[model samples]
Structures are given as structure tokens and as C-alpha cells.
Target: MTAYLPMDREERREMLASVGVDLDHLFDSIQESQKLKKTDFSGLQQEGISELEVVERLTALADLNKRTDDYDSYLGAGFYDHYQPAAVNHLISRTEFLTAYTPYQAEISQGTLQAIFEWQSYISRLSGMDVSNASLYDGASAAAEAALMACREKRLYKVFVSAGMHPEYIETIETYCHAAGVEVEVGALNEAGKTAEFPTEKGYAAYMVQSPNFYGVVEDLPLLVEKAHATGALAGASCDLISLALLQRPGDLGVDIVTGEAQALGIPMSFGGPGVGYMAVTQKLLRKMPGRIAGETVDRDGKTSYVLTIQAREQHIRRERATSNICTAQALMATSATIWLALMGSSGIRDVAEQSAAKALYLQEKLLATGLFENTYDSPVFREFALTAKGSLDLYKLNQDLLAEKIFGGLVVDDNRWLLAVTEKKSKQAMDKFVETVVRLAQAQ
Candidate 1:
């Protein structure tokens, strides 16, 4: 037990004894190094802290983060620095919206269910898929769950993932596959930062790719999807959701499943997450999608009504038939996304996508002109791109210096490479200043 908690040692021992397990047995599945000890935090003072002290402590810790309020961020691997409209926050905080967690009571949860239905509608239209679920945990889990859905559909144990996909997402897929006794094969990417052609062999349940993939280089979605279909495998994409505003819809490109992180849709990075994941599928695969789906209908009196419709998760069906164990939706974040989308109508979203892409190109050009960075691939980027550091460029020191100036430099990918992202919020002046700083720092190094 944690020292901070109010439980006494004897009570804890008694509780465990009643359950027929010791402390060690309770934590046996966890790695020994990760198991927390009594001394981990030094515990709170016996008298406890006042509200003011707690606020002071939290504020102090928050100040330690070298983030916005004084910084320009250029980091994006999965999450981004897209502008979050004030309206999104203002609307989602209303008592009628904020307090509702689940739509268990159809009659009482009309507002919550309606928000979810709109979310699903927006996602379905964005991906050009037949339908969408309410929500998933995050991009990684969404991709992993899509892979499982594909495997179940094809009744095949093997799946292939593009190396261009985010490394962490690939790791998540592997973890899920391992548990289900499925085989995962990682396909290589060509010099262009797109997944290479599938091996000259065929048996795969699915082939998953990420557009504007981890390298920030866009993939050839149509070609990849065709290749997957040629092998009788379902084609899926873990997309960069904002890019969908301008890029071809995955469904139109024959992508059978579309899964992605919606953090850019008005949600803050919040130091990497609490991301909301979305999954959209073709009509044929709708039954196998995990999580709940909100639907619109008419009440007996001919009044509009909203309710949870298709629920194929472990919570709704027999354990053996359930598509996934996920029981609840990330309703709050999903509602935020819906609000974001509603505020940023189609043209608004398109403008953001276009400006982000243009800014990315402008920054990439400016960086190359500094002669301290070189393009890593010939492929076009959306809002993020990778560049290799030139000679004598101290990437770490450069970032540290930038940090002192209240600016987050590019994400360090490796010793010789770094990835930079540009959002609609990053103006041309910021890009120019970033380039000038890089040049001066590299010259000094």
C-alpha cells in the first residue's frame, strides 16, 4: 500500500489475507523494479497540506515544464501544436455537457448521445467510411484494435505493419498481437519514406500504414491499399486526422479501416496525452468494431432521440464473441473533438490543413537555406518533416539554447537527425527566427 493512503499495515494485511494473497503475490505480474516501495514519496506531513499549499506545490511543478505561456513549440511525432479555439473549452465545460459521463439512460442522456453521434458522423465523413465508433483510448490502441478486427475478419493470424508507422504504435500492435497469438511482420520502407512493396508472398490479415507517418513524410495511400488488396488483406491506415482535411480520404483510397488520434482536434498535448482515438470502418466491418456507437432515431411520439446503438464490446456481448474488452468511451475528449469540429467547419479545417502544410514547407526551406540541415527524404510532408543535421551541428546544445529562449526546437530523432513540425499557429516570422537561431548555433558549434 502507498504511504500516502490512509490504510494501516494490519488492515492491509488482513484484507490481503482474506483474499488469500500476500503483497508480493498481488504484485507478482509487475516487474520488481517497477514495484513501488513505502519510501517512494517520503509521504505527506502528518498534519496534511492546506489547499493553498497544494495549489502552490502544483503551480511550482507546472512551472518546471518548458512549454507554452512563454514558448514556441515545434514538436510533433503524433501530437501537435494545432490552435485550440476558445469556444471548444467554453462549450464543453457547461454543466449539462461536462457532468454527463455515459449514456446509460437513453431518455436522460440525449445531449451526451447527440454529441457522440455527431462525433461519429464527423469521423465517418472525414475518413469517408461507412460508420465510426464513439471513441477509443488513443492512436496506438486504435491501430492495435483495428489490426485485431482485421485478423478476426480475415481469420488469418498474420498481419503486416509499415515501418513508416509510429514506432510506439507498432509496439502497441505487437503487444496486442502477442496476447491474441497472432503473428506480426514489419515491412520495410524505401528511401522515399514510404512502405516498400509487400514481399513476393501473400497471406496477411491486414496491412496497416500511417500517412504523414512517423518520418513526417506522406505515404502513397492508394498504391499501398491496392497492394494490400492484391494480397487479399484488409487495408488500414492510422491517419494524421488533420491531414484528412486536405489529403485523400482513406476510404476513397480503398482503406478498409481508418483509425487515428484526435489530439489535434482542439485537445492540448497535456504533456503527451489523454488522446482520443477514432476508428471508422467500411459497412462490412461495422459489426466487428469495438466500443459503443451513438445513433439518432425517433421516439414513439415522433420526437428526435439519441441513444447507444451498436455495442460489441465485452460489456455488451458474450465474452467469447466480444470484439474487444473496451467497455467505455472517452466521452469527454470525444466531446471536445466534436465541439472542435463543429466550430471549425469544413472550410475552417481545410484552411488549417493548408496553412499547416504551407508553413511546414516554408520552414523546411528556411532550415535547408541555413545549410545546417538537409532533407531526409524527397517525399512531401504535411505539417511535420525530418531533416538531417549538417556537420558540427550540436543538436542537443542547439535545443538547450532554444529552450533558454523559450522555444522548443525540433524533436531529436537520432544523433544525426531531428524532426520538426509546423502548425497553422507557427507564423512565418517564427519560422524565420528559428532558422536564424539554428544557423548561428550551428556556426558557433
Candidate 2:
């Protein structure tokens, strides 16, 4: 379809007249409350400039927003600045993989299907589940879908999420459930920063918790799963893909559903997106899973082939009865994850996770030694932890100071509490500098 853009006012008017439509009719679906009252761009006008000059101006503008190398960001709410191996991008950028669209013909799109199959296998192994779908928008949507999937078994309509889950994920589940008349109950986080029980029992289909949760504290997966099952609710555990290398697998903990953002696996942060969400479940719940699931099969000659199977649960076939409305998702990122996993193998991945945890513990101890901050929770954590800053400390001001020093401070949870995260990427010297910066800031305060 051609875009009906008019180069001149006369052409715009003529097209509107020919279509028997006014500007209002052209955008009739936009609610009055949702529409902006006036165009803000109307006041922004610039004189004629050459295309080269405009390009130069844009380059300068981009530089202004570009973060300098000196700044070390510790922020990771949903997105993290993990190191992505060059091979990951090189493989994903292959012409066939980069340009591929959704595979509609199972027979002809074997390459795409095979990649999805590998993605499913990796996710399944990581979560300790029997099966996984291709991918989803992100971790939050995946969590929401897991809730709906649990509802399929018992026809219950409520979802219980722990406050330890990323707040954004909790909000995403609520947004999805509201339209479906599914109530969401959020449980509180205990002093250990793990999710506690809900005040009252409700007919919930699923209970979602996060290990190495939003506050950077790990939850008690075995106990949490047991409690959820006692109420006949499915237990869904969201985890950091990298952390699973050291921690107990969600499936090993007896979780029915496991899902999380896979960005830390291999993909770049990419400004918080284009990240894939991985979901895996026991084979017993496979039929209720959403999104495209690639399966392996043989041809008439017994030659191996890959195909997308069991898709009747999706929107096009099931309509309102569909498991989910998610159609297409981050296949390219999923491919990146597959390549990264293959490159690292099991041992290499485990080393990365262990090294990251060690570095984080080193930083935690150093920070506490300064007597300016202390660990907020008493539980064992992964690569991230909550620290309580002392004195008349202003997080915004401290961050500003850290910015000037070319060091990114930890994420501020409150005026006095911050969440710090470390990875294999940061070296000993950098970690020392970060600690020195924090100590100086504390002394000044």
C-alpha cells in the first residue's frame, strides 16, 4: 500500500474531498481524550539547510546523548549492559537470518525453523523444563502469558505476583489481566528481600516470583513453589538467564513455568529492547503454551527437517479462545542467544556466572568496609545486591557527582538504598575506582 502523503496543501485538500472525508474522518478512531490538543511541532521551524549540514547537526546531537566510556552504569531494572560477543552479532547478521520473516511455510523455511528449535532447546535446558516456545516481546509479557496458560488448566482467573518481581513485570501482568477480568494480587517482600505470602488465599491460577528478584536478592524457590501448589496454583519463576548457570534450575526446584529476559545471555542492551523473552514449561503444559513452537520431524525419505507445530492455540486459529495474542517476536535475538550458548558451552557459561558473582561479592565487601554503606538484605544474592547509604546522602546529587567523575553509581531504590550490580565485564581496577568514588562521596556527604 502506498502512503497517501500530499506534497502540497492543494493536493491534501483534493485527496480529502475525493475520499469524502475530512481531517476528523481521517483520524476518527483517535479518542478525543487521547488526542493532543495542538501540534507542538508547529512552533518548531528552521531555515533552509543543506542535507550535508543537517547530517552534521544530527551527528553532533547524537554525540550529546552518547554516553562517555568513563561512566560505568550499574543500572539493571529490566535491561542490563552485558557484554555481547562479536560472533553473536556476526552470525545473526548473516543475510538469510537477518532478512528472514515469520515462517509461514514449514517445509521451505527449515533454516528459520531450525534456529527456533535450537532456541527452544537452549531455553528448556536452562529452565530445566521439557519445552519452550520461540520467544516473546520480553520477560514481562512472557510472565503474563504464563499466568494465562495456568488459567487454562483450572479455569481460574487470578494471578499472584511477588513484589520481588520486577515492578515493570508486575505492571505488565496487571495490564494484561485487567482486560481479561483476571484479578492480580501482589505479595510483599520480606526483610530478606524475598517474596512473602499473600495476606489472603484467592482462587489464583498462577503465582509468579523472581529469583535474584528486582531488589537483587534471590528468593526461596523450593518453598515458594510448594506454597503455590498447596493452593492449586501453578508456580512460575522468572530468573536471570545468566544466573541460572550457578543457581538451582527452576525446573529442579519443581517450578511448573519458568521465564525471563534473555538479554544477559548474549544480546546487547540496545537501549532496553529488541531483547527476547524465554518461556519454558513442563511437557504436561505444552499444549497451553503460546507463540510459535518449532518442532523436529522427518520427511518421507527419513531426512531430518524442522517445522512449526501445535500452533492451533495461537490467535489466528483459536481467536478469542487463543492462548495469547502474541504473533511475532525477537527471533533474531533468540538466534544470537543460541550462537552465544554454543560458543560458551556449559562450562564457559558457568564460569561467567561464577566470576560475575565473585566480583559482585568483592564490591559488596569493599563498600561495606568504608562504613558508609551496608548490605540491605541478609540473604545470598546473585550478581546484584541492595546497599544502604549512610549520612545526609542525596542519591540524585551523588549520581550527579559520580557522573562528573566518569563513574556510574548504583540504582537508587530509595533516598538511602541503592541496588548495585556487577558482571564479568568489570575488571579489578575499575571495581577499585568505583569503590573509591563511593567512599569519597560518603566522606563529602
Candidate 3:
């Protein structure tokens, strides 16, 4: 007796018949005995809780939890809240954009292909790389997949990853390569927050590192890339796309592959994902890249047309030799990014990046001004940094107090330090509020 959309026995039977299947086929992929075993549990039915009752119950539960209006978020190890233009969302959410799938049919999907082509061009220019794919699942997958591309050659038994690379991404790569039986080596960070180790003696496939890495410190690219290349290993960089507006481009830094999250551009941080990952590589490495790629050409009418180019990805070629198992791309999100960049243009994007950098510095200065916190790393960063507070205050408790002030504090880096993220969304007033709240909490302690 399910309260929601309960189907009568006859209706259920008709549903199964309409699908041209029986109950067994519905559970065909799973072991049949495991299909809602009758003896496993008790089924209880209350005569459907009233809508009002449900709302009141939820409200009561919420009331037990504290509410805060002063939320100043410092929780950006990766995703930051950047101001998205209204037009970006409005254009990307149209039914045609939202509901579309991969444009495998060139004749019917010119518009979608054009949008992807624009996205590719924008990403290529931004990364200072040659070609760009339509999009990947997210940054972590793109990083791991890029590693595979870099390390897939014979005689390359090992890959080196930077310690500053986001831990989750490292885990993802390890998981993917472990199944493939490839060994992974981790490079330790130097005191200046850059990758310092190089496996020059041992032959390897690639070195994977992140710029403005997990600790929010920028790593030395040219020297690190040179080191990897000196060992005959490909250099792959994972970076925050927004930061690229002001930082040295990956191509200029001699990176062979660049992959990173595009969520910061205009996509809202939907709590870890539903965002797009962008992967760009030098023309030399394009054949090894994964995901769908759009290319420009002329149609039969001699008018401009766009089609899925570099047909070596999972969706376009033989399953075994395909560069990836990914069949679906983040079509709508890529469109969002295209719209975002088109609206912002080059100068606007740079302005946003500059403002974010300035805001982060302002917050750092204010936090240091309190004389109650210290920087954990000494390096140039884009928008986030670590702040170590005096005394062993419980970060969870401090967070609770800050929430009461409606301020979201930074991530808890450790027992004594917290990682705070400042973006263009944060203003001087917001920084002041956070600083004041932290100072008050410190004084009380």
C-alpha cells in the first residue's frame, strides 16, 4: 500500500504487458531471488500521511536543526560561487538546449554542433592548447582519463601524480589504473607548495599535477613540465579554468594535456557536480584524448557545418579501441559555458578573475590583521588559502557559531587550520563580517 502512485494488481499486469515483458525481465539484470525478497522485512502502511502532516513534520525536524542567515562560505577547495550572468542561464535552459542529446546526426544537429564547436574554440583558446573536446563527465574523470592517454604506451609501467593534486582525483586515477594493472607514483610537494620530485631515472608515461592545487597554492609549471619531459614523460595539468584568465597558459608552460572543471565559469556549484569537465591537449596528443569532439566543415550546400570530429571516442568507434567508455557528454552544461563565455567575452572574464584574486587577498589580509591566524602555505594563490587559528578550537563548533552569524567559513584543513575560499561573490563587507566573527570567537576562546 504505497501512498504515492500505487498501481492496482491489474494495472501492474497491464504495465508489464505494455513493456513486452514479465516481472522476471524487469529484474533480468539482477539475481531474481534478490528481487524484494518477501521474508526480508515488514511492509507497513499508514493511510497516507496528510500533506499538511508531512510539511509540519519536516518543519519540526528542521526546527530541531539550527538556522543561520549569516552564511559566508569559505568551503571552496574546488568549486567556488562565481556570479553568472542572467542571459547564460536563460539561454541554456531553453527546451531545445536542455533536452538535446549528442549530435551524432550531422544533418539534424547543426545548431548543437555549432554550439559545441564554439565551446571547443573557447576552451582551446583559454587553455592555450590546440584542440578541445565537447566535455567530459567532470574534472576528476577528465584528469584520470588524461593520465591514461599520457601513459598508455608500451614500456611505460608507471605514472607520477602530484601530492597537491586533489586527493579525490588521485583516488579516481588509482581506481581506474588499478583495474588496468598500472603502477602510480605520487610526487611530494616542496616547501614552496610546488611539486619537487621527478622520477628521471625510472621510465614513466606521464606526470599529473594541478595548478593552484588542492591546497590553493599555484605550482611551478615550466620547471615541473621540463622535469617530466626530461624523463620522457608527458606532463598533464589539472587547473581551475577561471584562474586561467590571468595565469600562464598551459601551452606556454609546456604542458601536454590540460584538464579541469568548468563549473566555475557560469554553472552553479550543484554540490560537487552536475557540472562539465573540460579537456584540452596539444595537437600531438589529440589522437589519445577521450570524449566527443566537434569540428567545423562545409556541408553539401557549401554552407558552413559542424560534425563530430576525431571519431575515436567511445560513442564514435569500435568499443575495444575507444579512448573512453563515456557515451554521454554534458551537452546542456557545455552550452551554458558557451553562453557564459560569449556574454562575458575576454575582458569581462579577466575582470571576474582579477576581482576574485583581489577579494581573496583582501580576505587574507583581514584574517591576518586579526593576528589570530597564520597562513599554512607560502605561495601565490588565485582565490583560496589556508588559515591556521591559534589554540585547538574545534572546527565543527567554530563553524556552528559562524553559521549562527550566517557566515560560511572555510574548510577545516586540520585541527588547527581551516581552508577558506573567497570568490567574486564575496565582497569587502562579507570579508569584514567573517573576520569580525572569527575574532570574536577567538576572544571568547
TM-score, prediction 3? 0.90
The 0-to-1 C-alpha lDDT of every candidate, in the order given, reads: 0.87, 0.84, 0.82
Angstrom error at residue 238, model 1: 1.3
List residue ranges in candidate 1 displaced over 4 A. Answer: 1-44, 312-320
Q: Which stretches of candidate 3 lie over 4 Å from their true place?
A: 1-12, 15-20, 39-70, 153-155, 312-320
Can you list the residue pairs that collide in candidate 3?
69-406, 70-405, 70-406, 70-407, 71-406, 71-407, 71-408, 72-407, 72-408, 74-410
Better of 1 and 2 by lDDT: 1
RMSD of each: 4.7, 3.8, 3.7
Query: What stretches of model 2 exceed 4 Å from their correct place?
Result: 1-54, 68-70, 198-202, 317-319
Model 3 lowest lDDT segment of ten:
63-72
lDDT per residue for candidate 1 within 162-270, as digits (tens), equals 9989999999999999999999999888988888777556789999999989988889888878888888999999888789999999888889999999998979888
lDDT tens per residue, model 2, 1-445 = 3445546767777778897877567678988898778856656665668979989999998777535244687766667666778888888888679888888787779999999999999898888999999999899999988887888876999888898999889889998888888888898887888887653475889888998898778889998788888888889998898899998899988999998999888677766778889899998998888888999999999999998888753465666766677877689989988999999999989998998899889988988898877779988888888888776777778888888887777778868888888888888998898888877876686
TM-score of each: 0.89, 0.88, 0.90
Model 2 worst lDDT window (10 residues)? 62-71
Q: Please give the lDDT score for candidate 3.
A: 0.82
